[model samples]
Target: MTTNILFCGDASMTDGVLIATLSLMKQTRHPLHIFILTATLTVNGHHYRPFAAGTAERMTKLMQTQNSAHQLTRIDITDLFVADLPRANMKTMFTPYCMLRLFSDLVPELPDRVLYLDTDVVCRRPFDTFYNQSMAGVDIAGVLDHYGKWWFHHRLAWFDYLNSGVLLMSLAHIREDGLLVRCRQLVRHRWLFMPDQSALNIKAKFKRILPRKYNEQHQLKPDTVFQHFTTFFRFWPYFRIVTVKPWQIQAVHQQLGLHEYDDLLKDYRQLAPKLKEVS
Candidate 1:
């Protein structure tokens, strides 16, 4: 059978997500198809092609010397969505809010449903239980907000904070519906941080299916294998500017190795070698 899993990340991002994803492909019990949706260039001019695709292939190759990327498929955004990514997202591009919007736009016209993942996630165990569940009755399976209602609606709803880390949903509902259109309108209106999220929260209002250990945003237990790195940038030096706490990233980085953090720091021009190169 065909199970569609969606992930969004760029080349400049740390190789941790890349490693996590590859490892998951190796462990998944199904046919293990992966669809990566990422643009070729960053708004800053960094190239995503050689690094993202090349590393993915290298990792996959290393995992199974006899295997190809069959268990893994990459949806090159460079081949599809170019930088014309709506002009309104100028300020919020990397925010959690923007990731949701970009992910919504990347849904392809496919027969199978999609399990959208943030690049920061890794599967510690076979997630067949979560994957095979019925999403037909709900828009997605995600976390219920313990913090409070969607930040935008908190003043009005007084509910939980519904985080959008990992989601299993159908493309049909997003495409042939009013959600995507509303996202476009909100972006055009310059609503900023919550454009796509606003639409998603509104559409799936009170309908999120809290999966069993599926949306675990924190550390995983002994039985838990699939881990979604929800806190990659919480401690980001830019945290003061962005204001969101980074979580679960330090631990995940241990298995991914130094090269990942090495490059990520370089991407930010915070590394000495990278700085010397630029100078």
Candidate 2:
């Protein structure tokens, strides 16, 4: 069933978020209208530089491979780069947040009630039910914030900040309220506080917050649909995350058949095997 659209941004390079977004897209039960754009910048008045055209192409290939289930195709939605959005440019640091800010501003072109998900989130269920809701009255719907550190809480105007990593955004409010500007103000001030999450807090003071189950990822998740891999997301979700931190260079080196901790060589060797087998 073709349902309300759910959009997320993508970069030229396929980072952890792109991989996670594709994984979650595969898990969507109904036919999904997912939008993927890049937050590229215009260096000068004449030059156009995207986050990574090659990387975006690679991400397209990866998404196309799952065509049987998700069947997503790459398309260029806009030429607006990260720098053109005026005060909303704070989103460049936390890429996904900026992408959503773009979505909010451009909701007139988007489906009525769509879910704007971040790349770090993994889906455990079909997101159809979340789409068919009426967000006209409700402002925003996202997971409850997960305080990464003690100092994180103090940075916000209030303690209740929803996680923007995964959430349902209402296209109508995005165009009307002009919340993105306020949210960007927070981001520009390094009110970057919790990165993108802090910007959502700035919006949440006036915008409504979604329940916690949508992006649940801490401890035991009995009723969560997605898991936001914050700083503590060191292990794979479904895979039995072995007693190893994925960031551990030694562990990564051994897995990639690397002779040493060579950043350039390790990335190629590590990801090459996985892509080869899958391809």
Candidate 3:
């Protein structure tokens, strides 16, 4: 069966996306139907570049090399973005690209069920078990945020706040319940710490909490399937936030003290240079 995956980011996310793709390909031999959502926007005079067509073409070729049925499609949603602009949170620390996944329901090309992955995550094991899990009545399935679950509970004291980074979305259910529509409305009017993520937690009615292995945000464990390089808080030396992505090779080795993806990084180093020349 073809595994459908979705990613949303701007042009700057190319390196991370490439590295994430390589790591995922290494884990699974199934045909991957990858979709990247991007848009060119000018908010407050700062320009956001969309993924280049040439870059998409190059990535497509790379995927085909793994499996002939594997495909990468870049979809620009500039018009849709302008229609439902996140006015309240556009200027926040998070980039406008972070909100693109909110528009996925409106995009006709997306499959009914798709696994949405943040560009910063690296797949360490096959995800077919998680991807193929039944989503009969659930609008979305995700792992609880390592930090947000403790603080961002909406109504009940029990933590249900999920990280938006790795979401197994049931687009059909979302469309039926108008979950994305409500999320967009919430983000447009109210500004939250993490707008898109918070909106999802607040609006999604039926959500399934998966095991931490699906989105291991902290230190990698033996059972971790997707190692998410999310931000961490360090309070010992000085109060600071640490952010590390898979593409940052040196940081992965020295800062994180993790050498799990060294072979992948070596391959990335050899292949990444070609992305610049693609266009």
The candidate that wins on lDDT is: 3
Cα error of candidate 1 at position 158, Å:
6.9
- lDDT, model 2: 0.51
Model 3 weakest lDDT span, ten residues long = 270-279
- Give the alpha carbon lDDT tens digit for every residue of 106-155 in model 3: 99999999999999999999889999999999999999999989888875
TM-score against native, each model? 0.66, 0.61, 0.97
By lDDT, the better pick of 2 and 3 is: 3
lDDT, model 2, position 202: 54
Candidate 2 lDDT, 155-187, residue by residue in tens: 446555566767676656665676666655555
- How displaced is residue 84 in candidate 1, in Å? 5.8
Deviation (Å) of 117 in candidate 2 = 1.7
Assess the local accuracy of residue 70 in candidate 3 as a C-alpha lDDT between 0 and 100.
96
